[model samples]
Target: MDLKDEFYSAVDAVHNNISFEATTANEISTFETSIRFLGGLLSAHDLSGDARLLAKARDVGDMLYKAFDTPERMPIPKWDFHAALDEGSVQGSPGQLLLAEMGSYSLDFTRLSLLTRDPKYHELAARITDLLYETQMTTKVPGLWPSHVGLTADSLDRGSDYTFGAEADSAYEYTAKMVALLGGQVGQYEEMYARSVDAAAKYLFYRPLNPGDEDILVSGTARSHAGSGAPWTETSAQHLSCFAGGMLALGGRLTGNKSHVDMGGKLARGCVWLYKGGPRGLLPEATMLVACPDAGDCAWERDIGVWHDALRRKYGTSKPVEDVIADNRLPQGWVNIYGGCYILRPEAIESVFVLYRVTGDRKLMDEAWEMWAAIDKATRTAMANSAVEDVNPPGGKRLRMSDSMESFWLSETLKYFYLLYSEPELMSLDEWVFNTEAHPLRRMLS
Candidate 1:
């Protein structure tokens, strides 16, 4: 529509309100702030050649510089905006750092630097990627990094749970995308991505006993320690994990690696398989992967729905339990499955857009349509769209509707749906690669 002036004025107000030079009372964040605000400003400039947008992007980039003021060169996941006056809780070693926040810093910064002719922005961007490289190198898993890291805590060498979902998902995505954005000029990203693909294949990927009626393989988390390996757990892959397929496919297409593309296709189809298994045909926050293995022969022979207390006392969640039973839970093998309501996550359909774009697979397009219809049937409400509390109800029958809508629902999921079904040339993948948040960043070679 003819809303360019309104959009420009609105963005101008935001630009004036925010003091990107130094922190005031606002807190700074990466995944939320950078991916949306910064991504928005930079994207606007690129799309419309608006100098005002570029200026705002530069200011935001400068304001974000304080976030990187860490000893280890790792950007603090969150920054205190008032650190300019040295107020409460400044940026430094984070108590807990999310991988997505730490890892997904580059595209916006890189764009800012290229446009502004500033080297500092590039330096800041490089440090985050550099830290990601070193952190993955030290991790117990060959390619995968832990989901959460302390200012200095280790889960594998110590005990923190790891999963390639939610906060950790975007980090891996940025790696492949940075490679595409910079055009293979950077070898480190491609190298790290390759290692991750291989490691995921060997460790995280599994053939699970699922409702699909066929032996279907899906990727989950790897729970092995140094000098010890364990069988993959039955953690139902979250819809967040669905992005792996697109990320994989992007990596493969950029590098001419068929195996990566093939693996990505499987993961993408596996996500569709998840939708197929749901009661209402809408994807849940999570889907059942492998059925949880029995705790033990006694654990199984005793009861079907009850867990064996003695088995828990015996296993104690160590490497020894791998051979006994992975994801040993109360019973029924649902211990790994978080039967949460369908929360309209974007990862599944997001991947469909990518796979369809790359392979031109019309089947993926059809799946996207099916998913859209299911979402419409399940989520439409009297006031506005709402997420279902459960998908088990027929036609979303008696489903409690959430009043709130996630930003990604508009920015990403539905956007992907439109693009997936739109002309392939509208936003051609050859000219652009989206940020983890689905903001289109033009692929420019320097």
Candidate 2:
């Protein structure tokens, strides 16, 4: 328990840095706060049987719950906990969900319900997902979901683009884990996970391999929007989307599905490829046009009508998608179009840890070891670890530093590394499902 004690002590000290008596409402960032703070405290309580952790989780969870107020379909943003004042956007179209905010609350909230024996927290988290299901009842994409949505907007069509990054990353994660955490008590999550994955396999799962080689299914966005005559587009995968592989692998390994296991292995390999092939062995935020080489390419006055015209006007190109991809390949001074910084993100190696636990391959461990060395070398600073602003420095040149170190550095990154590097019997994948924030919830799989 030495590591656990150290972890608890370090995190406990963080509370002293905040002011409970501050006059202003602390900015409530649901996406970050829920995963790092609420998820951390709750998971610690689960793992250590610590009541203090539960109390902190309750306080923070209730404080952040203030954002859920509003007539809008999604939670409002940025509430002052003490003042009861909200400063979330006034321009939101009703019902449009921020995929990250809307989709990623189940772990902490469900755990809160388990601890408190109150269903309100579970219902609170479950309701947003119910809304997502309702939206799918009228979806534009057949099997895939838009990364963002407005509750009552014009029905989404097959041709619109979607993402698995920043504005939307963790929704898909919450789905599978929620059902697992609740032991199928909340069946909607199960339905949504199955439906989404089925749709994705048909539309977004790109198996870039020969007939019989080990499967390397790259999971990305699926957009079938074409002029009346053009082809559907498979979008590029992001570093963030790396989480999909682990989810699939864990789901497959837990359920005994060889296909999902194969795809999960492949997807994990694909994300690692981004880091290995990147300039400094640090994954870029986006991998541009990798999955969509000729997306929207059509001839005979391809019906891409208005959106195509708008694309041309914005970027001054006949093939906007291709142009955008090309631009992403360029490197600016402090930033790269494909997102140059290594912002202490943990999704790739997190998947690597999952893949290793699922498959027991030593190669993944060696790769992860090297990757960790590169990151530690690049990100170390005197005061605290900083994000690398531009990792693509000249040979033997050091990376530029950014001013921030995100909380995931502790909650997910360090946690995964510790677990991954530990003995296999500890927190084994067969026994637990971790939420997007890397909080392990212990449960016996069906």
Candidate 3:
């Protein structure tokens, strides 16, 4: 079959096999439970209007919406979607993928609200956004904390903190995108979005020690409130795929701030450093030490350890995991299904699509083509039922195609990918794809 056929077949396979009956079932695979993933596919079909695909996508959304209806005002994430959901409620936390597939599912669900024109979807989206705003605003430094609780003074607690690179809590990219698209509807939220983006750019994107290294930004930043609270340990910083890049794009669009645009550009170019020194032209998935002018011999073991664990689980721990596998290795430049490797694929694709839309540069198409080539080769699985692998360091295991899917992963990857190959204005890229599928289908207080 051709690419489109392969894509549709893949989606069909997941829709037929994956059950969204219970939270446990949905939580099993990262992709299987993702509302955003399905939402993106649906959005694509909505634009494309391929009835079969839309039917398949709509079924998944229906199941997910049903599964999410519970005592919790929003969907109770069966997996690691929320950072502190175990402790209490998080009204403002955007939907996030905590390890590729599990965590909050709010971001994509909100988009679904907009698409279906279901008042409940909008109501939930608003509620969730409001809660997140309220939770975050009270903090003296909202930049330091990951997410917030409800609106009331008592509910307002700055107890939860997100380590940078922890995909779930890094609301910059998720919220930035949310606000950029939806801010017009909620006039009051415009300021909150502006402040949130400012906080993230100031705290996370801008590095103090490596101030001169315009290319260098730590993947995450956080403080240990338990002990003497000092600057979040520099050693704690590491680089993950497109964390800064996505947020930069999100922040730029939300605020119309050129600085954010500059930051995004610099961050994208700075990614080259991660590529230049590695075994291949591949960037390290994680690094314990940021490239400094001075000392550089910090134990990067923790950074690679997480990679190794992920590699082993996805590809098997029997071999060394090279940072980036070549195109010949796998269809998507990865040897395993760990989301980190392919996580940035969509972001890069989205960035390319956005640039092309803005600049009409064939070079943007060239970039998209190059990225697609790597993705197509590195990740050969059907788009709907696809999984990635690590093949560089031979003797590693192969990850089976499973149910670990997410709406964010699908929406971002596919929509961006499709946009590169097709037109934009005529296309329907719904907000719900990102909110409901990518996040729990709920909204914060407005």
Candidate 4:
């Protein structure tokens, strides 16, 4: 099968099977809802030139615009991204990615607009991008916060107070990447994208989260640090893994920002140290090592294997890293429930691929295949099993599906999956990316 065909088949399985869209808002559906499924849909569309996925992405984007009806429609009164419209209105950081997601979708819509001359799609997308940029751009100390648009703008709105470092960083990365995606097509807007990312990196990226702290702290702000009242440290192995993976990509490929790469390496190394109980000052087993003071303190069993494997392989360990992971003496299942290890399987797989890409190692590929088998077996159930839910072995299951299933997850996850699996001759990095982004339908009708 051609690359496009294979991509389409996988995307179809995800779309028909996966419950949430790529930019899925758990219960709240107004945020960047269009881009939620765009990456996956775009991938499918690029492969088959099937208008269905393109139409679906456009339809969802249009629905979001209509639902918002106005800029007022986009903001939830309370700070909740997951709350249904009927449940309650929330304005907070959860939708930061939604804002960027919308930006990405709009950029794609712009492409469609240029290609097809569809003013409505093009105009709506531009408006959405403007609205999010206007609404989210902030001017606090650090500057730029991915604030959740308030639904009510009422006196009662308390707004979400805390933001993690990972989310904001991702938004920054997305902002730049999205712009770069279209800059070749639209010259002027590329600067806008560059400026936004530059601002984020300068103001938000360099600041210390846990000053004088043992673990290196990074905020996972869905927006800029200015938006989220307080910066929260992201301690979850999964969060770090994704963060490192993204930084590695952004720094290495996109902007050639070595600082981002260096920082990613630092964070990756720090995560390993923490996992190995190194840096004697701070205990690796401490649950609340950073801002996550209330999470599980023990090293997770199911995820530890994967996490340790990733860390070991990423750092180029000689023997199986699991030996050290196992020696850490973490309580069994400590990481399984609280840390959400299973949700990290794809991430671990991606990390292996990234390492392989950089180092040209075959062991990483072998490791990734092994990890994929575990994920396929344990998590791939037909109906409800589209997501990786935290399970307690024999019977217990965590019903709620976290944002881990979003498009970013799928995009990065499958990008690696296809890159590693597809024959090298069939893969051209630029062409592969283009297949996902450059389609006639993606251009709007002028």
RMSD of each: 6.6, 7.0, 10.0, 11.1
- Per TM-score, the best of the predicted structures is 1
Better of 1 and 2 by lDDT: 1
Query: Which candidate wins on lDDT?
Result: 1
Q: Please report, in order, the local distance difference test score of every candidate based on alpha carbons.
A: 0.70, 0.65, 0.45, 0.40
Model 4 spans with C-alpha error above 4 angstroms: 2-33, 36-41, 51-62, 71-104, 128-137, 141-144, 150-170, 184-244, 262-341, 344-370, 373-415, 423-427, 432-446
Query: Deviation in angstroms for 26 in model 4?
Result: 14
TM-score attained by model 3? 0.59
Q: Per model, how many backbone clashes are there? A: 2, 9, 64, 44
For 37-80, candidate 1 gives per-residue lDDT tens digits of 78888887877787888888887777677676666556666566
TM-score of each: 0.83, 0.78, 0.59, 0.54
Candidate 4 per-residue lDDT, tens place, 295-328, comes to 2332233233444444454436765555533543
lDDT of 3 by residue, 1-446 (tens): 13787777766776577544434322433334444456555555644456655555555566555434433444444534333234664334323323222223435555555556666644654654565566565554553344333223344343444443544343444555555456455554556556755665554543312322334444445443434454343333333434455456445655677676666655544443333332233333443333332323223332334334433555554455553333214322122322333323344445445544433556656655655555445445654534433223444445333334544455456656666667644232323213322322222222
**lDDT of candidate 4 vs native?**
0.40
Ranking of models by TM-score: 1, 2, 3, 4
As a whole number from 0 to 100, the lDDT of residue 117 in candidate 3 is 63
Candidate 2 residue runs with Cα over 4 Å from true position = 1-26, 80-95, 152-159, 207-215, 224-231, 289-337, 382-384, 393-398, 444-446
